[model samples]
Structures are given as structure tokens and as C-alpha cells.
Target: MLIMANNFFKPVGSKIFIINFYTFSKIENLIVWVNRSRYKNLDKIKYPAKAVIIDFSKCKPNIKPYHITPLACIIHEYQSKGYVIKLKNIPNNIECYLSSFNFQQFTENGSMIDIPVSSDCKILPLWLIKRNTYNLYPNRAKEYFENNHFDGLSLWPLSISLAELMNNIFDHSDSPIPGYTFTQYNATQDSIITCVCDFGVGIPVKVNNYLQTNNRGKLTNTGALLKAFEMNFSTKSQPHNKGYGLDNIISNIKLLNSKALIISNNVVYRIFPDNIEYTSELTVNFPGSLFVIWLNVNNLSVKEEEFADEAPL
Candidate 1:
């Protein structure tokens, strides 16, 4: 039986976020009320516990000023702990969202498959496919690249790197929740903005372990991230884990004059067309890793046949 340590409530802008679980047990009707919080983005804020409750009995069919992906990521974080997500009221759309991942009955009654929040954003399904959902990485990349008429080189890395990205989630992320992949084709920027996210054991832990074995001093999360881009560095113990996927992403990013950024734990690494850089100990520690790649297709012209020598994903 989990008991709240004390009565604690955080004033998130105008909203209230419970910090202490003292009242968590008394939350017969877990009502989640949100207003324009100081930071509309929940990820920017911090929480103290693993599981959260929501009572959507009165949630408007359409709720505005809500952040979907961030909330989803939070749920995934809790899921890793096998936390109980008690719900008093469940919405149909919300059920669909939760079902995208996996959930069993909580310590308290009620388990809804719907995702927490509902959004009108078309980017949801396209970007938030549950982990290991039919091995759709190849099809997803093809759809995005071909729809935009990107060069074949773009397809190669997109397909290969995306697969590697998903594989990393399975390989390193200890969470059972599937990783989520997001892609936004920004015509104005003339680039494919892609992000793969999961709330699991972040990159720093894996990289540091490898460092420990290789006699390298323990590295900060940032150091581990920066090192990950170099060729032949990997944390996988399997013989075939060549640690080649992300490096390939780097190679393609340069070939296309693009950019890639990987954020894990408290470190952030970026690779620009001209240089690669990293920053450590961000204001907040991300519960997991977020890998973002920008493929600038402004004037790409490489052909598919030209990428034959690339390794299999």
C-alpha cells in the first residue's frame, strides 16, 4: 500500500500538481484540473512521484491548452515502474491513446486504454505509433520521404536511422512501453524534422557502462552523448551491435547539409553541418532520451542506387 508522505501540491502556473502522495489514496475521484499553467508544457515542470491519477468524468470532449506528447511521455515514465494509473472517468479518445501502449489494472480499480489527453493534431497517429507495432519503420520512412519527393539518399538514412533509433529504444530503454517516433516536414524550413522518444533507461547509463569496461573514466551524460556519434562506439553486448546506426545518421546529416541532436539524461548533443557540439547538466533531467534529426531537403539530389554500400539497418 503506497501512502502519501505528506500533503503536497505544486502550483503549476494556475494548475495544481500533487507532489506528495499523502492524499493520493484519498483521491476517490481523481480529478485533474488544468488551467494556463506558468509553463503550458508539462515536460518543463517536474514531478515527484512515479504514478499519476486523472479523473476525466468532466473533461470536455475538446480540451485546449493541453500538451499531448509530453503527457504521453510522462505516462510511459510511470509505466516503467509498473505504477498504478487509477482513473475515475475515462474518455473514448483517451482510451485509444493509452491502448497505443500497454497497461494492466492498477492497484486501484479501472484501466483505460485511451491516452491521457485528446488532441486534434493530425501528427498524433503519424508520429505516435506504439513501439514494435508491426515493424512499420520502413514504411513510415518511405511515406515521409516519398511524399516530399526527397532524394533516395534521404530515404536511405531515414529508413536505416529510424530503424536504428527504434532498435535503440528496445535495446537500451528498459521500459515495456513502445518508443514513439515523430516527424514533421516543415516546408518553410525545407527539412524533415524527426524525433524518436521513450521514457526508459537513458543513453548516459549505457554509455557510462561501456566506458567503465573500456577503462575510460566515468563520463557525464553529455560526454557519453558526444562520444556516441563517433564510429564504432556502442553499448550493446551482442556481436552484431556494430554501433553504426547513429554514426550513419551523422554521415547522412553531413552529406545532406543537415543537423542532428540527441538529448539524454541531462546532456544534449548536436551535430551541425559544420561541427558537432554538446552541453551537459541541463536545467532538468529528461527521464529518457529524445533523438532529433533535421534532414534539409532544400536541394537534395542523391539517388537510391548511390547508397548501395550502406549497411543493413
Candidate 2:
């Protein structure tokens, strides 16, 4: 009986034993059914369960396969001891976890699919130009040219034209409300159209102010624009070379093969290489100026045909 009980309760390798069970002869077969019943209950009790604790301070950002020292240690210890350890509260660092373990098994089981860093698109705002401020107009124009990759020859004419136009804005207009704006639109396969505008007193109004004091008071906006074209007619009351800038602008427009429109004092003066004409109406609501230039950068006409070929083939 003692041998049977010892075989049943000794747990194979356990040192636990009852001291009084050593003596007895027929005890081996006695209560054998009860011993079997008790052995079945003992089989339900699990031994050597384990818990793994993880520390999170050594994690790095934007790297995968996180190194979990504690969990790895627990796994090693439990495997050696013939037991299993369950890890809890895995850190939110995904790259760390993925790199440390073959997370493909977990991911294949429909675990974590939404990655944090993956995104669709990003947006940014457009830059603006301020007017009436000296030095800024040229700086902004240079910036525009640089951003668009315009060559020195292509940039120079426009820069000169803008400088002259802005000079007029400051020199002639009374209470000049200075502001500038530019908008670009794709026109065709080889063409881009851009419009630049400013909210300030117009040229015709400034010319009319000069004319009004010079006994030419009844002159209209069209008359002012035409008179501005004249070599000697100027808005400056002082003895200075006033109309030179306008004349230079007209000459530069012809040289560059560009067109311009000057709207002021309820009139529009369209200036082109072939014709200089005007229309009268209060179309401009505020006290400002607008200059629109269209450059056909991709057009064969502007690129190849516009320039003279060197000698022969």
C-alpha cells in the first residue's frame, strides 16, 4: 500500500514524501480506486506558469523590430525550465516590434493593418507679393524668376518693365494704395498665362491731375494715355525728366514683343507693337494698377522661330 501511494503521489521527480507511510504490507492494493481518483485531480493542477515584464525606455523612433530585452529573457528562462511565459502590454512602437519578431504571423492572423506613417498626400500654400513697398517688387520678381527657372535674358526685360511700372506707381499717384498680386493659369500645350495686379492710383488719373493744373483741365483718360506717350508730356510739376520711364517702357515692350494695358481714370489703354488704342469706362473699381504678361515658354514660335538661326546648316 505504501509503495502504491508513493508511486501515485511522488510526482516522479518531486522530493515531497510522508514519513509515516514507510511501514505497512497490504497497503499497496488497499484503496487503489480512491488513489486513482485523487491522481486524476492532481493532473489538473499546472506547475511553473510564468509572466514576462517589459521596460519601454530604450525604444527608438522610426525603426522597426523593437528590442524587448525583458520578454526575450523571460522566453529563454521559461523554455529552459519547461514552462511557458505570456508577454503583456506590448509597446506602441511598431517598427521596434516588427524588427524584433517575425510579425508576419501575427499580421496574417488579422492583427494590425493600419500603419501610422503611411499617408496619401500633403498640401502647401501659395506665396503672395506685396505692392507700393520699394525694393520688395524687384526682390519678389527675382524670386519668381528663380522659382520658375527663367534665364537671365528672359528675366531682365520683365524685371526692367516691372521696375519702371512700380516707379510710376510711387512717383505719380496721389495717396497710392500699393498692393500686388499674380495668378498663373495653364493656357495650352506650350503656353502659360500670368496676370499681375496692383491696387493703387492709375496712370491716367495721375496724368489728368497734371493736365488739370496746366489749363488742359478738360482732357479725358484716353487723352491722358495718348499724351503720356508723347516725348515731352509729363505729370511731374517739378523740372525733372518725368515721361522718360513711360517712353522706355514702350520701347522695351516693342523690343521684347510683349503687350500691355494701362487702366486708369475710367479708361483702358491697350499698347501693342502695331497699334496703341484706348477705351473709356470706369471698369477699375479701386485705386490700383494691373499688369498682365503672357510668356509662351513651350511654344515653338517663341522658342525656335522667334530667334534667328546661326548662319546656315
Candidate 3:
């Protein structure tokens, strides 16, 4: 039986859990802390506990989407497992921001109240894409990009990257839950941050499983992740599935001098324009996967003809 630590969370009687700000101040802490809270005092709390309160009163005034998206993802994950989630002391603006994401759809009853969309809003609202309705993402995303002044060439890579990540949830992650995504564009920097997250069997597990089933041996979590980036590396058995998706993402990032952060299993991989870095030393393993990519909007210059490359000599 795991005990609820004083720093990360506080168990309120037998039903409610209070998650303090320290637990989610950083991405790493959020990922690990939530996992810890998930299994704590399982026997003490009744099935479908009353609520889990996230105390955000101590947070700063300005909260970005990156800060909220992962929190929302974890909250949704908990909700799926029968926990009622509630917010405590959320700043008015933060509450409004959450409303713009239409987070009311995930919460039951009046846990989250909706606020009208602000006229000056710049964010492309968060989307919940189910496997059966995954096809809707690209069209909506394209419209978002276009409305934000993203050129056709820029749309090529951005759309493909977003679509590919979404596709992986169904074709690779094998998750039953719906996927979540949202984009934040920085007009001054001419950059965009897109987050795609899902509750699924992570990449490493899927990759190693495929390898072991074929008697090809298993890989370390880090090794499996590295293998996932290589061209033609796929868990799929079909010959037509060449696994070009991740490879295209890597190439597009490099070409645009962009960056990406991928967290799956117990590992986090950082992809930069010049190099990639990864770490497997996570305090708690992620149950699924999250991808956050930063794209330099002005740097997208790939024409249709530039997409094809000649075979290496």
C-alpha cells in the first residue's frame, strides 16, 4: 500500500485527495507525482472516490497551455479510472483559459463551469479525438493553421506531423481512450507549440513487444525509443506500413530548425535541430505518451517537389 506523501498530495479523510501546486510545478514532477497519487491508499478510498482536488492557488498569474494540457491529460486519465476531479482555488483567468479548451466535456456535473470565449483569444481550442473520429483532426487543424496565417508549405509539414502523431495513438499506442491535442502560436516569435497526448500503452512497450514476438529480442526502454526513430522501423506487420511517419517528423523538425519533446514509458526524448537527447531515469513511468513540438512558422519552405529524396549511392 502506497502512502500519500505530504509534499505531493494530501489525503482528505477517505474519499478526497488534494494535490498541491508543488506536485505539478514542473512537467517531470507532474508526470511522476500523478502516478504516485493514482495508486496511493487504494484500499482506503471507496470505488469512485468523491473527488480529487488540484490546488492551484499558489501558481503564478500567467499560465501557458503547456502547463495546463498535461494536467488536463492526467486529470482525464484519472476520470477514466472513476475518480471525480475538481479544481480548487483556480485563478479566474486560468479558469477562463480552461473553459476555452471546453474542458467541461471531461468533467461530470458542475465540477467545471464554462466561461464564454474571449474575443481576443489566440489559442486553437483543445480537441478530443476518438479513434473512430480521428479523421476530423487534420481538417480542423488545417483550418486553424490557415486562420493563423500559416502558409500552404507550412501546413504540409505541420499537418502531417500532427496527423501522424494522432494516427500513432490508434495504430501504435492501441489506446481505448480518446486522444487530446491543442496548439498555441506565438506571433512575435513566429513559432507554434502543438501538444498531442494519449492514454495508451507507451511506445517502448509496443516496440519491445513486437520485437520479442518475432524472436528478435527486446530492447532497453531508451534503445526501443531510439529504434522507433529509424526509417522503416514499425510495430505493424503489414508491408505497406513502412513507418515513415516518425522519420518524416524528425526530418521536418530538422529542416525547419524546430524542436520536439517526446515522453513515453520511463523515458523523455528531446529532439533538437542538431541532435537528439534522451533519458530513462524517471521517478515514475508514464502510462501513455505525450508529444510537444515547437515549429518555426517562417522557416517552413518545403515545396511539393522538395519532398522526394534520391536513394543514397
Write down the TM-score of every candidate: 0.59, 0.43, 0.80
**lDDT for every model?**
0.53, 0.40, 0.68
- Model 3 lDDT vs. the true structure? 0.68
- Best-fitting candidate, scored by TM-score: 3
Ranking by TM-score: 3, 1, 2
For all candidates, the clash counts are 12, 12, 0
Candidate 3 residues 129-167, lDDT tens each? 664556666666666666657545546677788777877
Model 1, 98-159: lDDT tens per residue? 34432223223222332322132222232444543525754665554565455354456667
Q: How many backbone clashes does candidate 2 have?
A: 12
Stronger candidate by TM-score (2 vs 3): 3
| Model 3 lowest lDDT segment of ten | 110-119
Instruction: Report the lDDT tens digits of candidate 2 across residue range 1-313.
Output: 4454545333434322111111112212212312332211223334222322222233334321111211222233333333333223345665343433343232222112221111111100111232324445444554454355443324445555556655565566543233332323233422223333443456677777777787777566677766776765567633334446666666655555555655454555566534454455553232344454443343212222345566667
- Model 1 residue 126 distance off true place after TM-score fit, in angstroms: 4.9
